[model samples]
Target: MSQLSETTDGHLLKAITDACDGRIIQMPGPMAVTGVYPERSPPFKTIKLKGIEEFLLASARIGNRQPIILKLTPMDAVDYEAIEIESNKITQFEALEKHLVDHLGGYFNLLLGEAGADGLDAPYIASGHSLNAAITIFRREVEPLLARIKATRLAKAEQAAALAYADNDDWGTW
Candidate 1:
């Protein structure tokens, strides 16, 4: 059984890296984002992680043109009720969300320019090939990995709940 402790940052990082076949590299410095690119050439198949307010922006550059952008939030992948913390659980969740957002902020600033950075809520204008290889990779690779992580967390939470309520006599027959 995977414990809640398995969701640590290192574990998550390892999972992501392994999922990408080590194509995902940790960004240097204090940024919270990671880089995804091909093993041979970069900027040809590059994906940058950025934060826009409560969302994470995945900007992928397939060629020398602009990027294909996708926005997502932790809620898009994680279930609030499925995860808990030893301390205030809500606060911990909020912190993790904020951490991811903040981590992406620096990269977002670089991708969208200063004006766009200030107005993160504004809709992004992606001007490149739509439904291309980058988006395909995101859909096939990233999204499923996130769903799997969420499923793992949800399963652990459900098991814990069942154990906790196993001895309870409050409920009548369904």
Candidate 2:
């Protein structure tokens, strides 16, 4: 445990180092959208997602380790909602992508296109705040394993090709 390490934060540091084996990465999440969306200019949209405490402490070798990523969203309310849908709609992590293509896709379409044009007709969600959790997954440890697999496969193929060439040369005269 190195003191004054940049990666070392309070609880997150102890959580990562005090354990018996493996590596850990921990960071805070941005939980609020503080910017304003002006009308008649850029498309008006903002988002607030939750944070997750991830662990990659699998004791297996680099070839067998499985990285773990997890998050815990707070149970809080929101400041605004669509005029048509309920005001208190809470969002969740339905997909494991880099963006919110699943959670806010439909609402965004309505807000920027038809809903605004049709004179504010809300559907599933109307004007209310909601809490949501966000998560992104990665496997830096397993990547080496994958590379080893590919290398093994390629070597086998090359060996077979060499054997075939040798057999042809030896049998050509017979």
Best by lDDT: 1
lDDT accuracy of residue 83 in candidate 1: 13
- Candidate 1 lDDT over 1-174, as tens digits, reads 355223332233332222222121221222232223234343122223243213332222112232222222233342221111111111223433233333333322333342222355533323231223222332333333344556666888899988777777785335
Count of backbone collisions in candidate 1: 1
Each model's lDDT comes to 0.32, 0.29
List TM-score per model, in order. 0.21, 0.22
TM-score (C-alpha) between model 2 and the true structure: 0.22
Residues 62-119, model 2: lDDT tens digits: 1112211122121233332211111112133222221222333333333334213333
Task: Tell me, by TM-score, which candidate is best.
Answer: 2
lDDT, candidate 1, residue 28? 25
RMSD of each: 20.3, 21.7
